[model samples]
Target: MSAHSPLPSHELAIRVRALQVGFGTRLVLNNLELDVRRGEVLGFVGGSGTGKSVLARTILGLVQKRAGRVEVFGEDLDQLSKEGHRAMERRWGVLFQHGALFSGLTVLQNVQVPMREYLSLSPILMDELARLKIALVGLKPEAADKYPSELSGGMIKRAALARALALDPELVFLDEPTSGLDPISAAEFDELIKTLQQTLGLTVFMVTHDLDSLYSVCDRVAALADGKVIATGTIEQMLAAEHPWLRTYFHGTRASRLTLARAQSTGA
Candidate 1:
């Protein structure tokens, strides 16, 4: 229930209170409460099937909540009209776990999808803006013409990220952005995320299991267990937690090696 010292409501980008979600008889999230502050990367982690993605989806209004309040940019989601909800959606972007680019569309077309839906710009303008987003994400101009089938895994992630940024959103939700890449590629992607988040002044809510990404990019981390956030703090605080799961997850053999490597790298 405790988290990093909270920001005032005006400084929060997304807030969830007293959330409860269930499927049939099984409750996935029970009385979950979370806050995402503006202009920071908040990493959300949990064991597999622990409703991490569900929380993100519920906030985005993709899944129905049994009971709760979700507020984005200070407006309660339940209070918005259909038109108002659509407007609220324009303020955020999402990069799903897998690059959800359309198989039939080129990268440029895929990036233009949001623009086409949310804007009334001419085709030429849309094309130009889409190219700019592609370039912004570190993809080559030539990659704009390629289909998702033509990209490397890393390239696909970038292309998906470009599409996510198509609307120039203020808040972004990233689901396992580095999941499929090799170590080198994952590190590079993490750097790109950190850079873009800073440059764009974005509030990011990221659902991920990658320890390296947590260390390299996140400003704060929240861990979920038993259908609620069990702990929230810096990596060092998480490592020092007394909870059994936290003890096991952060001090296990692999994590010990990572900690040792980090200390050695920093000459700590």
Candidate 2:
């Protein structure tokens, strides 16, 4: 084969190498490796207890890793000084599973939390930005003053998403984004994510078990098992994978409704 043109190094969003994580005697991820490219929505999936969320947490620096390195936007996380770390943190946003919004804070205030922590903007500017984020995620102005308890599952998810996008982040980590929504609501949320990703040129690392979300929005799929990413490619490659877990996952009863048979084209 002729030599392929090289992709620019700046195109890498996240790179994990020789990662190891454990809690006491129980090791979760071992020697795991993965890469997320810029401007793509990469769906991460695995069976329950496979350490998908754990891996995400480790990369975010919320959970300590026993070994290996994580680099984001081409910078080694460990090498960054305190200020550098804070700067790095500003470039990415995260929406945890279960819409982890603060019950005491209203939706608008929640959206402004990151801004308060990372930015030095006037209150008037902050309010304007927060409202924009809420609207961007499909939430109404009325929902802005409601507490978490006042929102339904779907509304909470949208409010949480608005908070995640508050900083105009280049990348976002979504953990089970569609988890508790009704089918229709989930579909709508998936569409919103796709639109934002394209319009904003945001790279998304979505950890989800929702196959429909995977099929509808992902540019590529990565399957995790036994503490590492066992396979990664377009959805068609996932359906053809010989790996036992991936075989059942991609060709299972739940995946039967996808009408697209050809390999799903990834974004350049």
Candidate 3:
């Protein structure tokens, strides 16, 4: 963040270089490079099995990379000490697909998971903070005591988002956040994400196949194909691209539906 820090002064939240990952005889990501700047939403897209999630997990250290350098917040992940790594991990949040909330834990308890693991706050203070996060994500105060099973799908996503935000992370990674929701619910969630990103000055690295999300929220799009990012740019740039996959994706049937919806919303 500092002018003299090893990281670029312009604020690069995440940097990946020549990243390679393989499973048995197959390589999912090979010689891949990416950069996520601060205070922007980057929608990462790829065909099924093209490794969008794999790329995200590799950057988060959940998946091992066969090769490459991953720098986060001006520090190389592979070069950090154990304590340093722990500290760095605390600076980011993740909302996996399907919400990934703990079924047995109440909403408040779920939100407190990261705080409890990293900080030593008293019960009352932690409870207050957890509730604050819950409300911050647009959940009602009463929802805090409910279990994941009791919440609707949309509420579950909001709860998980609250938990992801509990630690006040500078960056967040969201994978397929709109996957199971109805179109209306998904649109609401997209608006919520956009609001949160602007209000919090948070950088977002999202892996999603949702055309509406990409069109409505993302500042940039990164298209992964054949083991690397083939194109990265705005929606118009993506539409203009000639990459086979990019063309098919941005001009496909699903994208047309979103276009129609946008036109209808604007009364065009």
lDDT (10s digit) by residue, model 1, range 1-268: 3953468787999888999999999999999989889999999999999999999999999899999899999999999999999998899999998888998999999999989999999999999999999998888999999999999988998899999999989999999999988999889888988998889998889999899998999998899999998998888889889999888888889888998999999996
In the range 107-198, model 2's lDDT, one tens digit per residue, is: 99999999999889999999999999998888899999999999998999999999999898999999999998999989999999999999
- TM-scores of the candidates are 0.95, 0.92, 0.92
Candidate 2 segments whose C-alpha is farther than 4 A from its true place:
1-8, 258-268
Off by over 4 Å in 3: 1-10, 260-267
Task: For each candidate in the order shown, give its overall lDDT on alpha carbons.
Answer: 0.91, 0.89, 0.89
Off by over 4 Å in 1: none
lDDT of 3 by residue, 102-209 (tens): 999999999999999999999999999999999887789999999999999888988999998989999999998888889988998899889999999999999999
Ranked by TM-score, the better of candidates 1 and 3 is 1
- Cα error of candidate 1 at position 257, Å: 1.0
Clashing pairs in 1: none
Q: After superposition, how far is residue 106 of candidate 1 from its true place, in Å?
A: 0.8
Lowest lDDT 10-residue stretch of candidate 3: 1-10
Which prediction has the highest TM-score against the true structure?
A: 1
Full-model lDDT, candidate 1: 0.91
